[model samples]
Target chain A: MKKKKSSIADKIFVACNTLFMIAFVVITLYPVLNTLAISFNDGIDAVRGGIYLVPRKFTLENYQTVLGKQNMMTGAYITLLRTIIGTVFALVSNALLAFIVSRKRFLFKSQLSLFWVITMYVNGGMIPVFLLYRNLHLTGTFWVYVVPGAVSAFNMLVLRTYMQGLPDSLEESAQLDGAGYWTVFSKIISPLCKPVYATVALFVAVYQWNSWFDAMLYNRMKSEYTTLQYELMKLLSSVMQQSGSAANAAAAGATASAVTPVSVRAAATIATMLPIICLYPFLQRYFVAGLTIGGVKE
Target chain B: MARNTKTNAPAVKITWKEVKRQKFLLFWAAVFVIYGVIFYYLPLGGWIMAFQNYKPKDGFLHSKFVGFDKFIFLFQDDTFLKVLRNTLGMGILNLVSTFIMAIVFAILLNEVRSKIGKKAVQTISYLPHFLSWIIVTGILHDALSTSGIVNEVLMKLNIIDKEVNFFAHPGFFWPIVAFANCWKETGWNAIIYLAAITSIDPCLYEAASIDGAGRWAKIRYITLPGIKPTIMILLLMNVGNVLNAGFEVQYLLGNGLIKSVSDTIDIYVLTWGISQNDYSLGTAAGIFKSVVSIILIVIANYMAKRAGEERLF
Candidate 1:
């Protein structure tokens, strides 16, 4: 129905809301576009200012520096391996756990699930966990990424809830055919639950890709084990220190002869975000379903 | 999920055959159970260090017992108290501002006429939520640099003669953090409220319009009350994390100059406890955080239930 009163205040509110949303769109896009522009801009020209939305002078030197930086190949290799391997490991382990606890024939069902649910509510904080890993000799090793996070309790509950919603007749029929638990899970439950698996896999991949705190905590002393995020963290922190003092850059006049701090940081930001920008949009539809199912603790 | 269903239906005899049949699944369960106990439960035992003069050489058993001393010391210390204040301040700032903005955005978005325009704005807004904080804070650092775009714009508008180094000033830290958090999360958080608003009965609005009530009046009387449950549920859930103000942004953005305000409990643990090799003190601090959080969430959920609001537990 159309507005009956059509009062000036209602019209003004609509206009104001429209403007606010438009402003929001600009604020969201500006940083990404500005970062993109700076990444392509020549270091020297970028520092001279007025490089708003487009490159003043185009160059690829920043990426080259990033790719060629010390031990970057190791970081990239570790990051790639961790993302793929870690996501798969987590999904498989958590899915198996979920299936066990979800089975109608399975005894101790509530107790089995409750064992994991408690861990979700309480954690032993960082240092204890760190010390535990240290005692296990998991520190300064690549397995730290894989072994510790193999089965997430939250993802287990989500997958279990999703699986439990499926027809029991499907499993009963499979059992009548003499199909084993693993067989039914592999052939039927696994394929039928692709949506939830995909959702959890996406979450795990993103977490692995975004994790630098673990790297910093466990592998900071081990130069060979630096992940891509930790590498970027180091790069960003160093450049931020340098760029914090603007006068030093102007006095040094080092932008032309060397890559400027802003451009390098921009390049680093772009490098870190490229994969996310490429992957997240394709998987965006799964986000709401994932969040709701994951949050369905009750 | 239905444990009694099969047991009550079949009345199958408990025998070695049934045990053999389920052995494989239970064997599978054993693997994760062990992993959980090792990774999740083992460390919980380490919290005992909070009550000890823990030494790496002596280990857990031999560490001299200093029962409740560390906690008393923690409370007596001014630095711990200050970080607690900082954490609570940032936490409350984030809670109120983010909730208000999300609700506002949801209401306003529901008012949009053009479907395309509304979808485009929402899609753009979701970009920041998925991005890494390192990237976001990097963007902020560049934009807030002395010669950055923000300073350039402010100077052009003659807001100040000189540039403002936002990170250098402790006074602006909380606002910057709160606003940035709102910018990142508002769109994502609004999705639930939008879902709530969409489910609102159209008949109410139609009746309000038939009675000559305007858009604002309909929204005030119907749409808000319609979405009150969603708001209550989210607010209750968030109360569980009231102490978890934020770690990533403050840790990344914090420098020595702004340490007074930027040093959250997480940072305090890292700098004063872990960095100084005072593991016992750090464990004490961590235990204190854990205990207080558990208490807060329990009380919050209890109050929510008492008020007939949405309770997380």
Candidate 2:
């Protein structure tokens, strides 16, 4: 009788837990769905503001308005270029640093490791860094986004920990065959380090893709060097400021009468969000694996 | 020659032979070390600006020495003090809410018995985390707008008589920032806790059940204790970041009406340093933030050591 009572209690708990989980999922997804609905809704109608899961009067003009903007195309190209270049540069730099430090017999291994780790703790704050970039003539150029961020102390540590786990025999055999440090690193350690490479790549790519502060701070005048996220930021902020005014609807440059700040902002937001959403399914496993690998306390 | 350096001798002298033997590796390492100095350490030289009555036209070398003046001005300024308060208030609120929500979500998700259901829910939870703050704040503004779903629902449910302009109220600013953080990060932050919980041995649960402990009893005794170390470690890490209330959400969502409660130290630095071109004052404020962060980290590390918990340092 006691066992049956416990079983009934377990059933009740499971039912409640299931309901909670369902609610959690709905709450997590509802905002994105609502945005999609509003983007599809006719802009002026959307301002009347009852749209939730479905558009009141469906239209595709908002997307056309967003996609047709010349600045959006320029921004997209810049964002893509930076992500590709930044990830490759950061990976190579961090991996080389990790390889150098990971060597068991290197004379300055511990010293070099300590040097980089100290950087993780504290450094010059923003104004100084900005001034330094200006001194180096990095500001107002595309290289500002790519060069200064080439080395990450955290990613280097993550890569180094992975490299240190490999058997010593791997490198010993490579050295026995007249391969120098470069050959051994490229031919042996790197291929073995693919999993970690993927993790660090995803991390750098996401950072580069999402970053807009650099453009806003350094290249605000250099419209040619703007990023997609910066463009989206500009769109969102402009919309937010004049949200009540119908003047922005015409300013958005859409021939369609339905184009309003609400619709344009929604469409631009979805445009910026699409790549991340699409790639998430495939990349989620790597990031989860990456986080677990990174979560291990040093 | 590598053998000489590898050996743990009482006195090891530098020799050209050893340097030559490892020349290839040494060369590249030196290049990166120089890169580190130029990028990481060189900027630190710019901190001198804080001690000077700095003018960009005068450059670092020509600026007049005015020790502590910028810092004194910062403390005396009412705006700086208010920004400090907003930073701490929102930072603490975000820290507590996000941390607790992540733990709760992890525990609740772990309670689900169906494998597919758990995976699906976890996947969906992490979706918002991948989004940029720009997107997240845009969605938030729309939802909290006077005619948005929140007001619509509240009015429909008869919870309130009319719409509340959430962003306009000083009292609502902190909670809005905290809620935005929780919404964006709860699932992502829970990943670590869930990983910690899963690492707990299943035998603990089995043993507890055999002892006639109920579900809540098992969780209370076993699960919570199992993840305590992780909780402590994460809490310690977050304590060091208590002042970093983040600039993105505040800058994106904040308005002139809510500026008093909305500005953080970072935003203050940007406005004064970059926008206003008061480099010395900005650098002083920035230095203050960096110093406080280091001190907090050191204190948290020391306390963790005293408590016999694992520390970050």
Candidate 3:
């Protein structure tokens, strides 16, 4: 709410804020638009510089080159597969654990919670975890992703809090009817917990989609197991090399450079980025509620 | 978890039927405990390798137990100390900049009158948060390149004589990473604060205006004080992640030339323990980081408690 009499300072502040917001919007949008421009522009034109906002000498060749690269399709398929299966597994295990413990009929609730909560305070750090995964012989295997992350303590807690908020009479009626735990969970609680479940599901899905570090750490040089993010990372690293040595390459002789790696790298960045951007608008409604649930403790 | 009045349900305690009925559910819950034990609790034993002359073949069991030798060696190493310096330097810088920027963004966004404009800006800004760091760093690398837009625009505007190799210089490393972090996270970080601001009663603004409070005065007094608890809670929580200045960005953006200013404890552990085959030393470095992190979090919680702010625990 503002006063009816707007002061000169208030007018100045409003003008300044408006200007700043416009500049802020441009600052945020420019790089993304530039990257898009580079991805579409002719490779030579992109490398020679001065391309911004819009494509210069536009071509789809960069995308073709990026998509046509070795193991590109395979990497996409792998990322898709892992994201689906991993999110499902994580949701099932975490939600079940949360729901089961949330039931008052089940004693040892505090102890069950404490067993997992202790993990939040202490960890073996990266080295030991890596070694443990190595010792388990899960590294370099697909199970490495699914098995370790099946039960996220944080997700479990969030789900538990949500489940706690549901009216008990619903479950009590089902219990009186001699409904089994699985029946009660499926026929009643599952329908009731959709919002929080969707929120947690989105978190795991995003985490699964974006993760490259685990694949890098565990899978090592296994190209077959490469994720989309890892493929993009590989492309980026190669672009770095080319950017560094393009001048050297020209001096040493060879005018056969059809497409600079920079263009393909931009294309690859967009490819890796496209999934999140496209899905984000639809999922945007879920994020604020998700973040609040995740950040705030009951 | 249900807060129902179940006192009228007839106390049917210590019944065999109930135990049989509940056994399956309890067993299912116990599976989580089993997984937690195997995945989390067990690896803690591997921290013992930090105190050993660890060799892969021998493992922690057969390795010669050398107490704090690796730690002393880590402290004695100049490179390791410099890595710590770079880590703390970048961590504090990022924390301060991002914290202020996020709050400022929240305050500014709260000042906007148009709902559509506010929502549109907020949506577009937090869009970066969904992106993986690998992608974020790739964008940074592209945009900050020698012949990239930054240099191109600067040179055209007669701001510079030539293209600046931003990544090549160690002195620019901390600020580059800090700004990159601010770009990616500031808007998203402001969301909670905006929610805090919205929760402040409109009557406060109305009352302040009647008292001849300007926009700046109201923001300084009412708006700020409303979000103080939220700010304190966030600060206390983030203090625990101080050591995690992050691994991916530094590892991606850094190279041998800037290694002096780029390496953090995570990078150090990865390079030394895994890559260099010095598992013991890496574990020692990791253990040092973890211990200090735990201490910092405890101290932060204590301070919050003393100040009558929100304590994490």
Candidate 4:
């Protein structure tokens, strides 16, 4: 009798759990899908509201307006350039530093490790870093996106941990073959560390792709260097500030009446999100592995 | 690390010959160390501006020194206090909401019987975590606009008489920030707990079931206890980060109407240090925040040590 009651309770529990999970998935996904729908909807029609999962008056004018702008094109170009260049620069530098510290025979290994570890806990905060950037003449340059962030202490430590796990025999054999540290690092360790390198590469790439603050802070005056995310931010903020009864007034002053700020903002947002959405499947695999590995330590 | 160095330093001799043997490695190491010093250590030198009436023209050397007056002024200022309160308020709200939601989601996710269903839900859930805060905030604005779906639902349910402009209210700011943080981070944060849960001994669950424990009983007795160490460690780590409520969300989502509840330490620093050109005061405020962060982290580490949980250090 007790077993029968317990089984019935378990069935009800499973039903409720399934319903909860379904709700969770819906809540997580509905916003993105709704945004997609709004982006395709006619701007003036959308202002009437009630557009949910599908467009009320479907149109491609929003995307056309967003993509036709010179700044938007430039922003996309810069974002792509930064993501590619920044990821490579950060990965190589971090791997090199990790290789140096991972060497067991190196006298400065512990000191080097300690040096990098301290950086993770303490920083000079924002103003000091901003001042330092100004002093270095890095405030207005493209290198501001690439160079200052080239070697993160956390990524370096993650790479070092992976390298430390590699057997000493690999390096010894390479050394026996007249290969120096660079050759061993470039030819041997780097190839062997491909899995971790992929993880770190994806991490850096996503960060570079998504970064807008650096552009806003350092290169705000340089319109040419603005990133896609920053451009979307500008559009979104303007729309949000004037979103109520004044939205149409602002829209009439802009380009065509077909593309309101809301619709254009949605279109730009979807455009900005395109790369991430395309890469998310691969990102999910590596990041899950990366988090489990990096999260285990400080 | 300090202990290891003290014991090993006396045993190793610094000789020119030993250094020369690893000249190539030493050369690269020296280059990186210099790079680290310039980029990392050099910034700390600018902290001295906190004590001076800093001027860009006079540089760090010739600035008129004011001791702790800037810091004193900060504490006495009403705006600074409000900013502090806002930062703490938003930070604690985000921490609690994200922390609890992640754990609860992980537990519920683990209970799903279908492997494919579990994987799909998790993959979809993590979609928001990868997007930039700008995109998240943009979506948030659209959803909470007076004519948006939230108001639509509330009206359909007859919860309110008419559409409510959610962001215009001062009281809703913290909760909105907390909800945004949960929406973006809960899924990503749950990954760790999910990993923890999977590692738990299946034997324990089997034993509990044989003892006539229901699903909730087993979860309470076995699963929750299994992941408690992770929960504690993550909580302590988050406690150390209670000041970092985040800047982009507040700065992007905020308007004049919500300024009192929205201004954070980062915004305060940006306004004074960068916009207002009061570098000394900004540096002083920045210094205060950093000092408090380090103190909180130390306290958290001490508590972890006392509690015999894993210490971050």
Candidate 5:
């Protein structure tokens, strides 16, 4: 009788869990869906009232305006190039460094680990980094974005930890076959570390794709090379400026309507986010696995 | 005995020769050393600017080094004081709320039995993390505006008489920012805690059940304690970055009306350094933040070590 009652309670628990999970999914996805709906909605209608869960008057005008601009196209291309180059460079360097550091027989293994950890906790902040870039004559170049953030300490540590967990017997066998360190690492270890490599690559790629702060800070007078996020920021700023100016004009007896400004900003946001969002499903499994592996140590 | 002696001598010499032979390791080490020296240690010298009347023209070598003058200025300036308070306040709020939510979420997730259900929930939750803050801020703008969903619902429920401009009000700004951060990060952060929880032996819960412990009791005793070390280590590491209340969200959300509460040392440095071209003062502020971060990390690590917990060192 007690067992039967507990089964009933367990069923109730499972039902509750399902309901809660559905609610969470809704809460998490609602904003993203709303933005997409607003981007498609007529700008004038979107700004006037609450339109949640669906688009009232569907229109592609806002998207047209966003994509029609020459600057947005160029900015998208720049961001794409940066993400590709930066991810590739970061992956190679981080993987190589991590492989070397993970070798148990390597002299100064602990020392090197300590060195990387110190970098994680301490750093010269923005100004000195800026000055360093300036002195190196990389201020206005594309290299500025790719080079400075090329090797993340967090990614390196995760990669190193993962590599350390790999079986030592495989490496020993490779060495017995007269393979050198480089050959053994490249052939034997690199193949085994695919999941982690993919994880770090995704991380670096996402970071590069989403980053606008550095572009804003370091790329002054280089507006031609603005990333997508930076372009979205500029779009939002201009929309605000236009609204403020329109209000001023209205006060001075001018009849100017800025109905679609918010819609256009929404469109820009959707455009900026679409690439990463599209990539998420492909990487979702690895991302979870990677987090589990990397996080287990901590 | 003679054969053993000869072999031992050659073996020792071969190991010594192998050490000399491995020049590639030394080469890479040197490269890393140079990278560290130039990037890490050299910039540390910039921290000296915090104590000086830093002028770009005077440079570090020629600058008049005043002792703790800028730090004193920081204390005296009402704006700086307010920002410091805001940083601490928001830091604590975010840390506590996010920590609790993540732990709860992880525990709940662990109870899930259906594989597809778990996968679906994890997939949905993790999706938000990939969205940039720019996109997140845009979402916030649309959802929290005067005529936004939040206000509309509140008004319909008679929670308020009028529409509330959430972004404009200083009192609501920090909470809104914190909530947005939690919304975006809580799912991703919970993955770690969940991993820690799942690694707990299933037998422990079984044993607890045999002892007549309820589900709640098991969670309280077993799950919570299992994840405590991970929690402590994360907390210790997070203390160093408490001041990094994030720049993008605040910069995007803040306006002149709420600037008093929203301006962090980072935004302050940006304004002074790049906008006004006062590089020295900007560098000084940045250096101050860095030093404080380092000190916090060291102190936290020391405390952890003393408490017999896992230390970063």
Candidate 6:
């Protein structure tokens, strides 16, 4: 009797687990896939009926329109440049700071660490940051993106913690082999810290990629150099606002003729998000391990 | 003890000498110090603009001093007050909903013993985190539009007599924003908790099973308690950022019609700082927000310490 009941319970457990897992998969994948379907669907069809899981009438016209727009392509180029330059500067600065802070024997390490931590808790906020950019003459320039957010405190802490976990014996052996501290750090420590470096690199890259707020705040000469996300936001907001105004006009007994190109907007969204989404699967292994390591307390 | 101290003297001396010899360490340290001084500390000095009627042309030092006027103006402004309320309301909603969903998702995900199934689920969920908020807002635009999928589905099901204007209505705006936040972030946020869940000893589950405990009982008695520390730590750390209610989504989703309910402190700052060119008022608001956040963090840390849990400090 006990054996039969236990088997039945086990079967129920497995079935429940499978059901939950499938639900999670569906909830996560559906919205993204839905967006993709809308992006591919013909604009008119996409608007008339909701494109859910699949495209009703498949088309790449939306992509062509978004890409063919000279402004968006220019924005993409600017964003790419910013990401590359910002990541490099951030990574170098962060790695150097982490190395210094990781050395327990270094004087004022604790004080410096506290300083960095305090920055994480408190900031001068956006306006002051804007003023600072203005003072430095960084606004409306490429340096606006790269210089202001060159180092992140959280990334520094993560790198420092990762470095701390490495055995001191490695540095000691390098010292015994007549290598200087710089040489050891460059030739030995950095190579060993690849996984953490890769992790930090990915974090910085994503930050640069998704960042539009900085551009929105500082870069007023939008025609000169807007980031990809910012351009998309502008486009989306404009369409929504136009539609809103049209509705108001109609409510006021005026002819509301302005139509929001919903398909074009969806296409722009899909286009803007395409590179990162495609890059995600490749970075999945590192991303999961990095997140797990970073979140797991020592 | 005397012999041990005498023997450690040479090691200590060597360590001191090594530190002195490594001038390169000092070089790199100085480089970082310079970076921080220029970028981090200098911007902080710009906070003085909060006390001044800051003009871009007048500059920080030359700006006319009007101490506390901007802050006073902020407190008196109805729009500012509404923004504050909206920020806190949306933040609290996001906090509660995301917290519940993350924990539930983590628990459910933990039950999956199939490797491939778990991996696939994880990959799909984590994808949204990589998406920019702009794109997410775009998705929401389409999904919640009058002729959008959500309304279509609802109408087909006879749930509503007419299309609901999900975005324009102030009452619905906050919830829609919160729901979008939860949808975008829950899976990614659950990851930390899921990692915590895995670290729980399997032997505890075995013991529960031996005691004839069912799955729910095992979860309550064993799993919940095990991940409680992780949850508490994350919650405390996040309390400092409650005012951040997110900028991009709220900004993108907000319209003039729903602005009263949707404008957050960040949006308020952006408006004053960028749109009006009243940098002083914006700086004042920003400073106020930052100060409150710091206070909350310190208090949270102190409370967590008293409770004998892991604190950010």
Backbone N/Cα/C clashes per model: 0, 0, 0, 0, 0, 0
What class would a CAPRI assessor give candidate 2's docking? Answer: medium
- lDDT by residue (A162-182, candidate 6, tens digit) is 787788888888889999888
Q: Pairs clashing in candidate 6?
A: none
**Native contacts present in candidate 4, fraction:** 0.63
Error of 5 at A18 (Å): 4.5
User: How do all models score by TM-score?
Assistant: 0.94, 0.95, 0.95, 0.95, 0.91, 0.91
> CAPRI band of model 3?
medium
Candidate 3 chain B minimal-lDDT segment of 10 residues: B1-10
* Superior candidate under TM-score, 4 versus 6: 4
| A5-46: candidate 1 lDDT, tens digit per residue | 678988898899889888888888898999999898887667
Task: Give me candidate 5's TM-score against the actual structure.
Answer: 0.91
Candidate 4, A65-94: lDDT as tens digits? 998999999999999999999999999999
Pairs of residues at least 3 apart in sequence or in different chains that clash in candidate 5: none
lDDT of candidate 6 over B1-313, digit per residue (tens): 0001011112223366766776788777777778787778877887888899877787767889998999999999999998889888888898888889889888888777667877778778777788888888877786787867777889989999899888878899878988888778887888888888888998888877778887778889999999999898888878888887657788888888888888999999988887898878888888888888788878988999999987776
Where is model 5 more than 4 Å wrong at Cα?
Answer: A1-3, A7-19, A240-259, A296-298, B1-16
Descending-lDDT candidate ranking: 4, 2, 3, 1, 6, 5
**Winner by lDDT between candidate 5 and candidate 2:** 2
> Could you give candidate 5's per-residue lDDT for residues B1-313 as a string of tens digits?
0001011112222266666644565567667767667767677776777677777778878888888777676668787677667777777788787778777777888778778878778777877788888888877876786667887889999999998878678899888888888888878888888878878998888888778766678889999999998898888878888887657788887888888888777888788777887666677677767778889889998999999988666
DockQ of 3: 0.55
TM-scores, chain B, all models: 0.91, 0.94, 0.93, 0.94, 0.89, 0.93
On the 0 to 100 scale, the lDDT of residue A213 in model 6 is: 80
Q: Whose DockQ is higher: candidate 2's or candidate 6's?
A: 2
DockQ of 2: 0.51
What C-alpha RMSD does candidate 2 show over the true interface residues after superposing them? 5.5
Q: Score the docking of each candidate (DockQ).
A: 0.53, 0.51, 0.55, 0.55, 0.43, 0.46
Tell me the tens digit of each residue's lDDT in model 3 across A62-105.
89987788777877888898999999999889888988878877
Candidate 2 vs candidate 4, TM-score winner = 4
Locate the minimum summed-lDDT window of 10 residues in model 5 chain A: A249-258
lDDT of candidate 2 over B41-125, digit per residue (tens): 9888889999998998999999999999999999999999999999988889999999899998999899887789999899988
